[model samples]
Target: MMTVNEVSRLTGVSIRALHYYDQIGLLPATGHTDSGYRLYDDTALEHLQQILLFRELEFSLKDIQRILSNSAFDREKALKQQIELLKLKRQHIEDLIALAEKTQTTGGTIMDFTAFDTQKIKDYAAQAKQQWGATPEYKEFEQKTALKTEKEVSAMGGQLMEIIAAFGKMQSMDPAAPAVQAQVKKLQDFISEHYYTCSKTILGQLGQLYTAGGAFTQNINAAGGPGTAEFASKAIEVYCRTAK
Candidate 1:
């Protein structure tokens, strides 16, 4: 058994933090000494180690508690997830450094908009492997998509413009109407097919981009007029909820 102070000294975590953890029921006292001092057994020590590891990974205490209390918690899985997350963070920092160096040499001519692209090609490869195995399915899909000519890309863009035009025509209609919702689904499906994988997080972010300004918003608005993008965002949100 170890005293709270001993655990604090050993783990380099503050004693007050240990007390707060106990108060929150995240790290309850294992037992009480004869004089009523809190004591932690080996199991509690192990729990502390896990908690500290999660803290190092920048997980909120609540998130860590939920993870630690889950019956399916696996040390190996947790370590693997942490390692991936840390590697991503390191890569993000490196990208930022590279972008800064580019800015220094380009005399502000070359933009660092590439940094805003949070999605990495390696992540797509990993997802492909996990979903379709180590086969050539992903490669085939990539080849087919790449074979698309300028005309094909323009045709897809035309389809999006048509959707935007319809949205503009329905500007005065109820935002919850089935017609608008249908357009939203069509847009999402189009994105999933032509763009990267369309997760809810990514979709929501892209929807925001339509009205968030910058070249993307400018292009969308120029096609269908102002408020086109905002309406699309609302309609897309509704579609996402129903589709899910």
Candidate 2:
């Protein structure tokens, strides 16, 4: 058996973290010395390694606990999942780096944008340009956004938050009301004028996306206040039902 300090030295995991893991029942030691020191066997080290891998992949402690404790937990399967997620994340970072290099000022260092969806955002930006660049709305939208400097984009994002805040104000009302529907229309128009032509189907998906969590959900909830995402989602569902 190895002491907590031994594991820390060997794996570079802090003793504090290991203790927390034990506190959370994540990586309890196999035994304890009579003098009250924690002792971990070789099998416990393997479990710790798996926990570290999940942490590197950004899995929450609660999720990691459930997964590792499950009877179906398979080390090989987990490693494969880790590999795929890492590759996808690396690709996103790489593409952002390449794009930043092209548009950046001379010698400007690439800023960390982990909270931003570099790939997904770029994909949405290109969607209309690829699908309907010939349409006047797309052309007009492209022209407008094309002139936006980085500061303008930031400002535009702030304006978008105001729209979301407006939606939050209507949360107590029935989602099928004319007022709610009008706000939904405004939201659709906002995307069509700024980004892409947001049809009812796409609008519905965007509502779900807002509630899906991450920085997007965080920003929406922060801007519009709590329950805003769910409110918008319910409103979008009602709007889509009416459209059909």
Candidate 3:
């Protein structure tokens, strides 16, 4: 495990930015040391690499989180898209450089502004974003959240965590118990009501994400204590299996 500072130095990301990412449920540390220092494992580092790639493409943090959090996200496919976008960006820059040189040679009197056009890059990016976020659930989430204030969204997140935390308190009980299954149903209902329609398949995917050792796991553990995320994941698994 590497310290947060070490990660910051390695990735050239600011310590403050990393902390903010943690706060916003982006790139959470894989675990914490006994002394309360944040620690990241190789998996977390790989996630960070993906985030940085999206950042390089000028994606907003919110968009990056949404894209990465999707259970269907494909890292290799995303990498290919990022490479294509970067090549376009590089070509744009080269065009601008050539324009600048030509203008300089012509005594800076050229009035042509065609080189300033960036419609191609912008259109490609828009198309890529649409492709990545085209799921019905994602569309519903976007529509629902488009009207909410940031504070309201944060409150909703807190409420969801509270439900997960409840699972932590029931860790001693059988995960397949009726009570645990009810809680899983409640979680699914909450997601369907507020964010998107949470089908059994989606719920199962979320269960995996809850214990996938990233911000979701860290935040759930922070709220409910250690091992809570795993317990909830188990409960979810049981719920999905029985409900089907």
Considering every candidate listed, which one attains the maximal TM-score? 3
Model 1 per-residue lDDT tens digits across residues 1-244: 8998888889898889887766554576666679977777777787788778767656656446535533334667777766776677677778888888888888685654776565763564344223322324334435545777544544554565566546766778776798887777777666677644566766666677666643334435445667777888777676666666
Residues 1-244 of candidate 3: C-alpha lDDT, one tens digit per residue = 8999999999999999888776655676677899988888887888899999899989877678777876667788889989999999999899889989998888766787878888988898888789878888889988999988765665676677778879999999999998999999999999999899999999999999988865557767866788999999999999988896
lDDT by candidate, in order shown = 0.63, 0.68, 0.84
**Candidate 3 TM-score over all chains jointly:** 0.83
Worst 10 residues of 1 by lDDT: 128-137
lDDT of 2: 0.68
Model 3 / residue 236 / CA error / Å = 2.0
Better of 2 and 3 by lDDT: 3
TM-score of 2: 0.44
Candidate 1 TM-score to native: 0.41
Badly placed stretches (over 4 Å) of model 3 are 149-162, 165-169, 208-230, 241-244
